[model samples]
Target: MENYPKSINASSLNDWYNSEKEDPVLIDVREHSELEIACFPKEFLHIPISKVTSTYVEELFAGLFEREIVVACHAGIRSYNFCQWSLDNNIVSEIWNLEEGIDGWSRYIDPSIPRY
Candidate 1:
């Protein structure tokens, strides 16, 4: 598979969902306070950006090196940054950022969810 950190948009994500038969890793990188403002899929794993240091991030993803990871954040900036970092650091994982993030999600995708 191609390196995932470069970028991945929402529309492409829909295709990925359609094409991929298995459940990929979904990681939420937002802060706790931000999460209070908006929530993601219940299946998502919380590994806040605050804890994305060399130690913590490595520890958090310790056993999931081979998983396909989709990194999400409030607006997608942090998740994009993390994707780049992960790629640069030689962590072998696929990462996709939800373009527009929860804001876009609330605005265009699903309105039932509250927006911050």
Candidate 2:
């Protein structure tokens, strides 16, 4: 928990997604209702932060060890908490929290996504 998780802004994330050979795991940790309002254009693993149990972590770990992960929420708060919980629970060593979250994305990457 001492070592902070990496944070990626919408602009940087867009650049990385565009240039990187393999895509990172884009995770939308926002609730179902929140997603109905807006979401990332890219396909993502939509596991709400409330539902991320140990079983879910094990499943993610089993298959996603090789891929980078970026977690997002409405405004970056929940995603940050998720990142810290992941590290504190020893889920993964490298995980990123999307800074400012999808609100940032709506502002920077895709204006089409309506902000709540």
Candidate 3:
């Protein structure tokens, strides 16, 4: 199985998501209110960072072990921590972090996504 990269830039991430292949799952860890300021693709899984727990993990994500996963947040910090935690806990073998988060996506890929 191919290992996920530690991080991926907004441009590369855009391309990856748009490709015809089986794309990675984009998990937005930002809180619900953050969506009012900026948003990502509709396909992204909405799992707020604050609510991530063992029960949540087992219930929602256990089936995704073999799938490519990418976590994102406002500025990448929370997602980075989550990715590390996932790895440590054996939740998933590998997960990619959005290097600059949705903020980077606004600056690099889509300017329409308002930055807050």
Please estimate how well model 3 matches the true structure, expressed as its whole-model Cα lDDT: 0.86
Q: What lDDT would each prediction earn against the true structure?
A: 0.74, 0.88, 0.86
Write one digit per residue (lDDT tens) for candidate 3, span 2-106. Answer: 344499999998888788978988899999999878999548888898999967875778778778898999999999988887777678877899999999999
Candidate 1 residue runs with Cα over 4 Å from true position = 1-6, 11-20
**Between 1 and 2, whose lDDT is larger?**
2
- Considering TM-score, which of the candidate structures 1 and 2 is the better prediction for this target? 2
Under the 3 Å rule for N, CA and C atoms, how many clashes does model 3 have? Answer: 0
- What's the lDDT for residue 102 in model 2? 91
TM-score list, all predictions? 0.81, 0.93, 0.90
What lDDT score goes with residue 65 in model 2? 82
Residue 28's lDDT within candidate 1 is 83
Among all candidates shown, the one with the greatest lDDT = 2
Error (Å) of candidate 2 at residue 43 is 1.2
Tell me which residue pairs clash in candidate 2. none
- TM-score winner between 1 and 3, please give it: 3
lDDT of 1 at 79: 86
